[model samples]
Target: MQEEFISSKQNAKVKNWRKLKTAKGRKQQGLYMIEGEHLIEEAVRSGVYLEAIILNETYEGAYPTGFSTYRLAAHVFESLAETDSPQGILAILGAQSRFNAAEDFQQLLAKPGDAINRWLLVDGVQDPGNLGTIIRTADAAGYRGVVLGTGTVDLYNDKVLRSTQGSHWHIEVVELPIETAMQTLQGAGIPVLATALHREARDYRTLDYAAGAPLALVVGNEGQGVQAKLIEQANLSVFIPMPGQAESLNVAVATGILLFAL
Candidate 1:
């Protein structure tokens, strides 16, 4: 592998690298940038399509071999970095489409080995950190996949990606209309439960089910909770009873608790 050195920030490649830091640029180019050695390690281990790897001249850490590599001047590297303490390594990776078609959803459900029936659905989860934490928690809780509804934060946002800690590669993430996803799951005989604080809502712990039965859990926006119309469509509405003085739990924290329960 040849190591190219970049000294001028005005170079076209350097300008493009800086552009990828924005959402518009990422969308236009169909690529996203991840920094730090840990994320680069995760990307290498997952064998995802990588456009290139970049390093600062002073970096002495190990990096994956057999890929396009570049060494940048310290000032040039700082211009492209978003973190205070840069690990001196960054990677540009091809973006994957978030849309998992309805047919593909069914195909995943009908797979031969390890039928995945448990799903976590998010409706208008706007906070990047919250959404990322929720996705990471869903992965840890062994959910089949995450369905992101409209009005949710961008899945590929830098903050979200960082918060996930590479959990995104471990699980499937699908962006689809909440109503359509809910209907599809319900038609497949999976129960759709919404998390809400309503008089009619039941305690999450009281849910009755077989160990391996198909289930879907819907978590909503941080400020408003689940939309009333969506909750109305749910088979049941459940809440984590809080007897303390706090008004409500953080959406991510509530999601983790409910995911483990259901």
Candidate 2:
């Protein structure tokens, strides 16, 4: 089908894109805006429905004709896009698959199977940028999937989607309460790994990752790391071996290292 190109900012669809730019708007619409070429491409592959795709007049992207698209004037796209240097191609995609802790856990158990299903669990990582980058890195390192505990960033938030750069489509991100998640993983016989600052965390590399037991690598908040209750619940505490003078690696980077190592 030939895409119906839209150049006016007043178009109904464009107005919705504007709303998706804000956090409140995304929550209200149950959708989000993705502002770059690569991110949109990745989201599409991840099975997200592209309600509409907008492109700057200057960009020429290769996409299947089956997906609806709009070609906006360069000025209009720049006005709506959030990137520092907007690439001119943007899209508004449907949100990730929502999960009720009770329902989804049973399904995910199979994905991170017997041979040490390496997984990343996020507990209250609020900033969208950090969450998105962490998700993206998790995808690259081939972690079986991710679990989001309470207080974590909105997976469908536009900023998180942008930061993921399309990695969202590749991994399973399950959001649920910390306690519920712990029970499910434990019931399935998977070991849970927690990252802590000054506690019982052993060196990261020393863990035997190749053993193929189900594993969940948990990262905590920016200020407090993992919560006390959750930390105590962990089966293992592994610290990222930081030899430099710096205090710590950003949570996303730390997540990436642990994921890749596993």
RMSD for each of the candidates? 1.6, 2.7
TM-score to true structure, per model: 0.94, 0.86
Local distance difference test, candidate 2: 0.77
lDDT (0 to 1) per candidate: 0.88, 0.77
Tens digits of per-residue lDDT, candidate 2, 113-231, equal: 42236678899999899999998888777776778888897787768877877777776778788768877887888788888866677888777766555678789998788898888
* Model 2 spans > 4 angstroms off: 2-8, 45-47, 58-63, 110-116
Error of 2 at 210 (Å): 2.9
Error of 1 at 30 (Å): 1.6
Give per-residue lDDT, candidate 2, residue 119. Answer: 71
What's the true lDDT of residue 239 in model 2? 88
Model 1 lDDT on a 0 to 1 scale: 0.88
Cα lDDT tens digits, model 1, 1-262, are 9999999999899899898888889989999889888888998898788999899989999998888999999999999888899999999999876765787777666665343578899999999999999999989988878999989988878889998988888787898888888888888888899998889999988988776778999999989988998899999999998889999999999999988776
